[model samples]
Target: MFICSLFFIYIGEQLDVEKNLKKTAVLVGNAVFYVPSIIKMTTIGGIYLLAILLPSFLAGYRDYTIGTDVLVYGNIWFHNAILSNNFWNYLEWANNSSIGVLYATFNYVVSRFTSNVHIFYFWYSFVETALVLMTLRKNRIDIVLGMSTYYFLFFNLTLNILRQSLAMIVIVWGFNYVTEKKLWKYLLIILIASGFHSTAMIAIIIYPLYWIANNREKLLNVFVLSVCILFIVFSEKLTVLALNIGMLNERYSDYLMNSNIRGGFFAHLLFCLPILILYLTAKNNIGGSRDSQRYNGFRLIVAFTTVLSGFNLKYVYLGRVTQYFDFLFLLAVPYIGNRYYVKIGRYRDTLVTKLLIYIYLITYWIIIYGVQNSGETVPYILNFN
Candidate 1:
């Protein structure tokens, strides 16, 4: 799996360069452009081969977090009689209240067929990975760096948020529909995903915002400032309403009120400063007016949401909102790395960029592993193992 992942990453990077080269060649009316286009076509074939092999690799990897969550869901379903009442209740509160129904359902279907829940996790991981890869492919991103970034966000740490991960798939599906101007498909997917997790319903509002805000690059900074202030002043009230309206677990009420996961007040400011610097530096350097405008707009949104995540712990949910923007950066980073660092200078200049990437990877890994290894819960399957 790791080897295949590396191969896909290489193909994606090569194709990215080739695609750009083709666009440049078209502008210059040069026959030399054919070389890059041909290389891109070859890379496409390599990508397809890697995609074919990904499933086998993912299937062999253990999803430790999903295994633990499944066990927690099973125990809640079986141990608590309230959750076993009916299918609706099973869907709504089984993981929190009743373990029997959840256990029975899984045992009758998922567990009964598989050797253990880890296998189920593996399958889910594979499907999620495939869905993300398809989404990126559709977006015309085929590079290894792009795939790595997508995998890190969607399959790595996100495995802990099973419902949210599924919601993300629906959200991306909705994004495609919106981009294609397919209203019905977009709404349908959003609604279906909302049924699985109520938080997804928020996308109904966010989608419209996404549409309206698509071209509004300057407004992103304003929106970020506004959301920060609104959350800061009304956080308690918002938490109360969220709990009352059943958007948040009641147990989290106190945590929301008293906990201080706010990181640092200036943390977001610090992060945004670099992006702001990049934007200023690249504003004139970028080619293609339309593409530059789109990138600027997208970067603003990403910067806004990332800053908001640090302003308040409750805005942790807004992490999903920032993820869409983070994806843009993930793609841009490698291109930028290649352009300014790798191409203009020695490959050694790319070392800093690579170190920054590894730093992010390691930091996220620590956060995820810390949460998973806290030992508050254990998967039933692993217990047997």
Candidate 2:
């Protein structure tokens, strides 16, 4: 934990707000860094690779952390799953979970081969790490920023919300085809992901929303603002109605109806500040084709998260929904900062603005990594020991 604390500080200092500040690499998820590292594997390059892999290894090795999700949801579920030898039993389990058949089948197949949950966990962690790392490289998200955000927010999720994490990975992977406009391939991928986590189906709407955003930016902003306002006024009522819907999955229903835990105001504020800052600063007349697509993609996600953040203010439990979209901001904020700010604008390059961003990111790191321990891999455990 102490080492992680120092690492966070070092990375914070290393985030050069001024470098590559004018490129789409920030918006499109291309990470800005020392170019020399990319040309050849130097010391910085080695650190980048280590930064990506260390957390994944820790997650894979974790046994039972004192967190609500990992202790019960992951370890116990994997144990219970293996007990059912009959195919029908696995189906029954999947039915109760309201998860996809392939998801259940995957677990059942793994159970047949090994009873140790650690083995299954490592497999999930490794695959998840691969998926996320591939997405970072494929999309060109800065390695440090992407990995930092993943560790800070999404890593704990991979521990507990096993199905949805896999679903997220699938949806992220599907974007490759989505950007290509290969409708059939994208739909198939989404369908496969939904099998693991039904909530993944919501991503199906993203493409259409992208079309709306790219073509109708003004209307889309208005719509998002309206939705946010509406959610604020009638969130409780809407939450009730959503829960009452007969077709809602049992697990989702439980989370909404039964779970009482809600992330506080500070957490919501912290979660949203990065995007809001970048968005307010975003300017046009810059970036390339890659930048345009990535910008639109993140802008669309930011709009949804902005609305959901409002919903979270009222229906606190609705906060969970933000995870689906918030991950993109890791790229969006950096993109917006580099693309729009630091152009010697009246306010952007001023000492105060530069200092403020560094201070904010630094403070955020302290809270998220040092204090909150949200990733729940602190004092990282090695399973073999």
Tell me, by TM-score, which candidate is best.
Answer: 2
- Models 1 onward score TM values of 0.60, 0.71
lDDT value, candidate 2, whole model: 0.59
Q: Give the per-residue lDDT of model 2 (tens digit) for 258-348.
A: 2222244466567676656555555643568766876776776676666566556556655555555655554555455445544354644
lDDT (Cα atoms) of all candidates against the true structure: 0.48, 0.59
Residue 67 deviation, candidate 2, in Å?
Answer: 3.9
**Tens-digit lDDT string for candidate 1 (97-207):** 322232344433444355455455555555556666666556554345545555443344344444455556657645566555577887887676654444454454444
What is the total number of backbone clashes in candidate 2? 9
lDDT of 1: 0.48
Q: RMSDs, each prediction?
A: 8.5, 7.8
